[model samples]
Target: MTHPMALPVVRTLNTDRHRVALQVFMVVVVAHWAEHLAQAVQIYVLGMPTSEARGVLGLPFPWLVHSEWMHYGYALVMMVGLILLRPGFVGKARTWWTAALLIQVWHHFEHLLLLLQALVGTNIASRPVPTSLLQLALPRVELHLFYNAIVFIPMVVAMIKHGKPSDEELAAAPCRCAPAKV
Candidate 1:
């Protein structure tokens, strides 16, 4: 028998509500990716200075790149979103979603470490600013772009698989990501 407290949690994660929530979360994720991509284009394509290459929203909030809190918050959200929506995925979609979740977990850890260092008034490898572990090899902006790309690829794959699930997968899904039966 399910515990009373667990019942709501199960229902939240196992209903059509979860699918809608996942779709909304993915829109936010894509927006973030666009920001990163825009930033990259500003630097590499437009020849803008790194400091001046703030993307769309960054034009007004140029300090976003310097804010550990913002980075950590995004990482945390991605992790939580992936975990919360995972129960609704099944079969191939589940596998791809798990892949994205695993990568995001690692990405979250990197941001966590960076945030901790910033909070402690220290920096990775004694750099002047907060730095992720991978930042030692790649600059922070580029590293984040790489991280987002890797995570997003699998996420997109999962969404595709979810939308056109196999018959068995459709049967297992608690939500209607698959097309309705005629």
Candidate 2:
């Protein structure tokens, strides 16, 4: 018998509910991507200075760009969301989802390190800013863009695969991502 606590979680991740949850998660992920892309365009395409190139929401709340808490919170959300939605995936979708989850886990760790440094008042490499390890090689903005890209690509692939699952995958899936017969 399923544990009482697990029953709700299992139900949430099953069939139609899982698909709806995934859709909501994907919308959030895409919105974040749009923000990052907007920031990048402001920097490269529009020739705006980095400080002035804050994305849509960042333009209104510029402090968000420098807020380690905000960054860490988003990272944590991504990690948790990926994990929670993972059980709904099967076969190739599961593989791709796992890949995204693994990358997001590392991304979360980097943000966590940055958050800890911020709390302790010691930035990485004695730099003035909170620095991720990769930030040493690339600017923070560019580094995040790369990280998001890598995570997003596999996630998109996973969604595509989920939509047109193999017969075995469809059989294994508790959710209905596949199309119905005419």
Candidate 3:
């Protein structure tokens, strides 16, 4: 005869697993959305006129856009599997969370430079803005900064919440694949 307590313990564990999965999903989706929007604005709205051309930041524009989506998709799907299939990842959630924030920070800077060029470059001056992306009268530079602060800031906060660990806590965590005794 088992104790009645066993079922509640099982339910709590399952609940935690679901919560972690959702958190991971949100991180990936948000990252992909930002990258896609940035790419679309530059390529379709700015009218640089060629997908093969380099972006203002000197990146091959279409390649950057395509690669960003592919990378995000791969990471999101793999992370979901890791959370569900692998027990160790849950315990090591901090590492995964930090990695997500780091990737976003890199992307934030990349887009920042592109926005700067779009607002001021003579090359862009000749190209008429598309009605679909944004009105020409709006300040593109300010808009970019505002979006960076509003959208990416939350992602950074979530990453720090999920990933950070005290020095002592990290020290106590066992090293991967402990050496076998002779």
Candidate 4:
């Protein structure tokens, strides 16, 4: 008897699932730090600090943090949400080194927005100035790049090797579903 060649093989990570969860958890914990995550959102949305700072550029700085526990709680929730959703680009690496490079580059772009605020004040006008033109850029830029590599590397490697699940696989997992038509 001949067997079918195209049977769907369910691929699961044999290792490092716990590691992925831990790394994601750390991001959630650190995201509560005002400078790291909260401030990033505040600046991106309203162009100012969240700690009762005066507004800028016709936007009121979110004073939400002044309430203590609530702000960090919300930030933690947001961080978890961010990691649960696949960022999509991490899977395209042709090689491990390439994946590392892409992860660093993506992080640099993401962090650059914050650096602009740190050095030249949180003004939209600073967006145009090249980094070389600035008197100061954020300290430890390389460290941030490295950290992002560590966080994204495993996930990217897994994605490159395993690939994403199809709609049928996802829909069928632990749930009843109508059979697909041949």
Candidate 5:
């Protein structure tokens, strides 16, 4: 009943291209998490000054860590990945993936707040640094960690469910994320 070209791009992405696209998206997400973890380790374990503990990528291009544009861009990318790749999932996997996407909506909003402050040259409550709504209560580093953990956990759960899908899920799947049964 669907038009042939109605959602051709989405259909292709969800079918043949889904596996590669999801893998690439995951790599970026994991790499960003690694950067944050590296920064935390540098400060806590290596006893480096907080300001000097630039993460792996930040060591070479420090602006990557400091720029609100960069951070917001990443949030935007995460949301896009979650949205675009969603149709490939089915059953429990779809539910879990949507959970991640919903959490990311708030996460994206936080980054948008920071980016807007940077663009407007005014921070929330006249603070010295750009701040998010939750940043008012939690330290920035802890907040970022918290956000990553919540998002990553659900995503991992979705991936695992997708991989070991029920027969119904397997039947309904649009992509070959799971192995075929003999």
Candidate 6:
């Protein structure tokens, strides 16, 4: 059974508002990607100090860079967006979108671990600041960049497939995302 609140939201998002919902979701994902890219460029290309390498928004809100809650919030939002819009996808688009969603589930778990570590004032295995499981092998910045890329790549592919769906797919799809059928 669906939660009372989830019923209408899932219906509207998957139906009448699907196209706009997808556009909004894509903007959020791309913005997050851009922020990560900006941070990487600041550190690797511009030789900015690591502490000072807050991305565009973080420049204005430096504490955001250090706040595990902020990171966790973004991860949660990404996961929710993926889940909410998932039903709008069908066939090949659904497969690729599911791939992105599954990867994001792991990414969200990592962020949750970091947030828990921060809240408890203990690193996961007791070293320094909060560290994710993957951070064991890769640095935090690189890990996040890697996570974002994998999720974004599959999501983009899904969007491309969604936009050029087959004739049957177009007929069954809820929103007008693809070109008009001749």
lDDT, candidate 6, residue 93?
A: 94
lDDT for each residue of candidate 3 in 45-136, tens digit (9 for 90 to 100): 87654454333332544455324334444444534433332222223444554454455444444444344444555334455431112324
Candidates 3 and 4 compared by TM-score, better number: 3
Residue 110 deviation, candidate 6, in Å? 0.1
Clashing pairs in 5: none
lDDT of 5 by residue, 133-156 (tens): 999999998899899989999999
Clash counts for the predictions, in order: 0, 0, 1, 0, 0, 0
Model 3 residue pairs with clashes: 94-163
Q: Give the worst 10-residue stretch by lDDT in candidate 1.
A: 2-11
Error of 5 at 54 (Å): 1.3
Look at candidate 4 and give me any clashing residue pairs.
Answer: none
Q: Tell me the spans in candidate 2 whose CA falls farther than 4 Å from its real position.
A: 1-7
> For residues 23-59, could you state the per-residue lDDT of candidate 6 as single tens digits?
9998999899899999999999999987899988899
lDDT of each residue in 1-182, candidate 1, tens digit only: 85422567756765757667877998999899999999999999999998899888889887887788998999999998888788788898889999999999999999999999989998877898878888888987889899998999999999999889888888888887678766
Candidate 5 stretches greater than 4 Å from native? 1-5
Candidate 3 vs. true structure, TM-score: 0.28
Off by over 4 Å in 6: 2-6
Residue 127 lDDT, candidate 6, scale 0-100: 67
State the displacement of the C-alpha of residue 98, model 4, in Å, after optimal TM-score superposition: 14
Q: What lDDT tens digits, residue by residue, belong to model 2 across residues 55-127?
A: 9999889998888999899999899889888878899999999999999999999999999999999988999
Q: Poorest 10 consecutive residues of model 3 by lDDT? A: 173-182
Better by lDDT, candidate 6 or 2: 6
Worst 10 residues of 5 by lDDT: 2-11
